[model samples]
Target: MTARPLGVEIACDGPTGHYDCPHNAAIRAQFTSRTARQVRADGRRDGWRARPGGLDICPDCVKETTR
Candidate 1:
């Protein structure tokens, strides 16, 4: 996540009602010991990378944290 003027702009939730996205089988519904980090092109394409100013967060992680 990126540092926002107010605070860190972490992902809040997914578009679907479920935190888990059926469309993306690569991602899991829950995270335990994961720490949100910046994504580089060299890293796994499965995850998202933060934009120059925006943060990247998986749909599942976003939903779980928001709740």
Candidate 2:
């Protein structure tokens, strides 16, 4: 079976915002090595949550938020 890409949970500051966010992209790029443990640690440090599943931010969100 194919393994799913690890996803990081970008915590909502106030209200439930779009999943696609620059912060999420930055974090994912920063942790492309797939060191989930380290990613999680870093996420916690950065006030985000890195975990499993398809929680990665979507491209639309990235475009909208980044712009």
Candidate 3:
């Protein structure tokens, strides 16, 4: 039997990115924050990018970029 994902993950959007099983991207998008920082924090909590830009990068990609 094949294992199915419980929730859709928000993948990293660096130079190269792929689907990841981290969190529910849909739920993450439903969240709303008053401040940019808070927005970043929320996104971060969902394994999404916290940086300010049109593009997004997952936590794993963040580590790769920082390195």
Candidate 4:
């Protein structure tokens, strides 16, 4: 997942290397303060990306789900 940017902080356990997973992507978007969003997998090798949602509370929402 590619995030425009964010200003929030997040801690992941499953995947922390790439900003793809909807969970992680949410963090990057919320924390980094990203606007434009898009989630596309180039191929099997590539993972998923986070696209823009109607709301802004994303990463935080992810954290809540994990809990």
Q: Which candidate ranks first by TM-score, i.e. highest?
A: 3
Q: List the residue pairs that clash in candidate 3.
A: none
lDDT at residue 39 of model 1 (Cα atoms): 20
lDDT of each: 0.37, 0.44, 0.52, 0.34
**Per-residue CA lDDT of candidate 3, range 1-67, in tens?**
9995343334345534445424323324334454445555667777666445656676656666678
True-vs-predicted CA distance for residue 35, candidate 4, Å: 10
15-39, model 2: which lDDT tens digit per residue? Answer: 1243335444444325464565556
**Model 3 regions more than 4 Å off:** 1-11, 15-42, 50-52
Model 3, residue 15: C-alpha shift (Å): 4.6
Please tell me which model should have the higher TM-score, number 1 or number 3.
Answer: 3
Which prediction has the highest lDDT against the true structure? 3
**Candidate 2 deviates by what RMSD?**
8.7
Using all chains and alpha carbons, the TM-scores for the candidates as numbered come to 0.22, 0.30, 0.36, 0.19
Better-scoring candidate (lDDT), 1 or 2: 2
Better of 3 and 4 by TM-score: 3
Worst 10 residues of 3 by lDDT: 21-30
Q: Write down the lDDT that model 3 would get.
A: 0.52
Q: Is candidate 2 or candidate 3 better by lDDT?
A: 3
